[model samples]
Target: MEISTRRLKLLAILGYFLTGITGGVIIYGSEKMIVATKTPILIFMVWSGLVLVIVSLIGIYGVIKINFGYTVLSSFALVVVSITLINHLMYAIIKDRSEVESDRKVLKLWNRHMLMGRAMHKIQDRLDCCGIYGFQDYILNDKQVPVSCVSEELVSYIYKQLGCKEASLREYLFSRNFIIFSEFTSLLLNMITAVAGFKLCSRIDRGI
Candidate 1:
């Protein structure tokens, strides 16, 4: 809603501190693993992620002292985190589907709809509304169901979360706002976190 400058600064500081701690842990763990395992790719990753984390940390200071600077930076940081979070969520959905049924309990009634087509068909019979597969994509009088349970959920989640109030997944995907800022904030935060962490970890690439 409406947050004052002071509130924003406080939020920024908390966000920065947590991000920094996590990034620090990642860097430390990676360093030790890199040294012990001698994995080239992993080593490089440590440095790259470290850099992003540090930049994010600096964004915190900028936000607190430099006025709206941190807000701008924090938006970017949010983007970064959003991207990674979306990626992970996708991965989870895929993983869940591959190993077991995609109908996780957490997904609620949606779970029953995915695994058992018959059950979904029955649900359609009960409700005047169209058949719900994941959240949207209702089976109409004439429509073919697509495969990929994980993809179904992913699209559905995005569509419902960012979609028009009444629009289905089909319509939500086409929303201009979703396309533009779908994951913008997350990408920014990811970059910020990485940059700040790298800056903080001086001994990373240079071997200090």
Candidate 2:
């Protein structure tokens, strides 16, 4: 069975488009879970996703134009993104998970961003939690426990027992691990498609 140059190009373009779409959806879905949790490592996931999408678009354009230069650029970008993503995943996997759940770290992160504060408020409200550690940790400027800390239900229940630190930590670790796996798989596929496309373009240019 023989494949034509045009068919190869089309397949390559499809690969890039599908990979890009998949990545966008994955990031969007994970954003809600990670939104409340602020950390330096999370920023790379956002930036790398954007870069992958851009490079995927470039790859599609290159396939359409039959331009090897564009294909090479896309391939190079994919390699860089793949390496960075792998490293990020390694760090996430190898790092001390307990340290990431520190009360002080969570509190500092909550204070760093107003958006994070809003996110945490929403999370706490939904989870019926008080603060990072407990109600005592919520004291600020003589302010009482936030409304979220109190259970809305009149029935007896332990609302204050659920702390944001543990909830956030669970969500963060789950989301991070999932993102790492997804991106790593997509990166490998995208790199293969990119390299194949580049070579096909070269062969076509040389009239092989």
Candidate 3:
């Protein structure tokens, strides 16, 4: 019984550590990516991390105190984490699909006038890309190719060869895919942790 209790405590501690690391990674990754501010997936991921961190803390405390109630609470928290992850995953997929479809319309708006033109220029500068499709887009639109399209070395041969649309899409897709992968991985881990938490609760309830 003593050995079982010791193992349970250790498992709780491990859960706390793993959840902490996972939460930190997700938050950090979101910050580093160029995703839109306060995006749904981003907000959901932040909240998910916070909730998991709290859940892990509860698990640790419950194990330390051998409290059946706290143990059960933590298990419920893990269930919450699982549900949120699944919700966010589905939302992210739908959002990605919709965004891809709307990219052209968004780009057209961005190319409409001087104000949006400046915004597009900033994107071009940041991504080191040219117009929608290439430098030829500027010619087609009767606009001058901005300096943002040029490389630092001003290599004439490759000038304005890359397109802002492609670059931005690539970055967006990469960020979305990364977040999706993280959520899926976290969901799996949460399931395992929840199972372990339930087992631990049973042992504590039996006065093991």
Candidate 4:
């Protein structure tokens, strides 16, 4: 395809602008949400989103080239952030439900994971897992569950109930969490990639 030099510059500039804007919005929203909510999860989102926004900004100047390094880090960032987000997001939205049957079903496995994880922890307070930096010593059962080692039995039951035909307990626990988040994160990922692809396509459209 024949290309024009000026259009290529425009495409690159547009990529820089769009990513920068998205990153900015996420960063600002995260900061606001952090202050507004005392909940552990919201605090976690602020922290995660802060990091993600930073990475996204890296794309602004040089996402296309190998030297950018943004592409390398983004994959790891998205996967980790997505899992944490899904579990907590689900918990937050489900809080109002009166343990109703449909609602309970949606929540049961996730709740069990947290409960059994807490029981396994069996500690007062030290490290906050997946929430925020530094451990807050106050325990809230009505407070959030502490980070802990989950029991094997709890893992197995969750796996079986979730329709696992194969019975590897390890597969159920760690992998299941990934499976739960993979779908939601894919949506976010598509949004990101779509924006990126658009920037690239725009170059072609303009004869860049």
Residues 1-208, candidate 4: write the lDDT tens digits. 7435455445544544544454455446545433322234435544655654564555433435533245434434544555665666576545522223323332343355355644313221211121121122213334453333222343543111221111122222332243234335533653554344344545445545
| Residue runs of model 3 more than 4 Å from their true location after superposition | 1-3, 34-38, 90-109, 153-160
- Whole-model lDDT per candidate: 0.43, 0.69, 0.72, 0.40
33-132 in candidate 2: lDDT tens per residue?
5555555555566666677788889989887887778888887777777777777777877784644554655666456523434435676764456677
Rate residue 38 of model 1 by lDDT: 30
Q: Which pairs clash in the backbone of model 4?
A: 4-207, 140-143
TM per candidate: 0.37, 0.78, 0.78, 0.36
Worst 10 residues of 4 by lDDT: 124-133
Q: For model 1, how does the per-residue alpha-carbon lDDT over 141-186 read when each residue is reduced to its tens digit?
A: 3335423222224343422222112122233222212222323443
Query: Model 1 compared with the native: what TM-score?
Result: 0.37
RMSD of 2: 4.1
What candidate 2 gets wrong by more than 4 Å, as runs, is: 1-3, 96-102, 109-123, 126-128, 134-143, 152-155, 158-160
C-alpha displacement of 171 in model 2, angstroms?
1.8
lDDT at position 30, candidate 3: 74
RMSD of each: 16.3, 4.1, 3.4, 15.4
lDDT of 4 at 91: 64
Task: Report the candidate with higher lDDT, 2 versus 3.
Answer: 3
Which candidate would rank higher by TM-score, 2 or 4? 2
Native-referenced Cα lDDT, model 4? 0.40
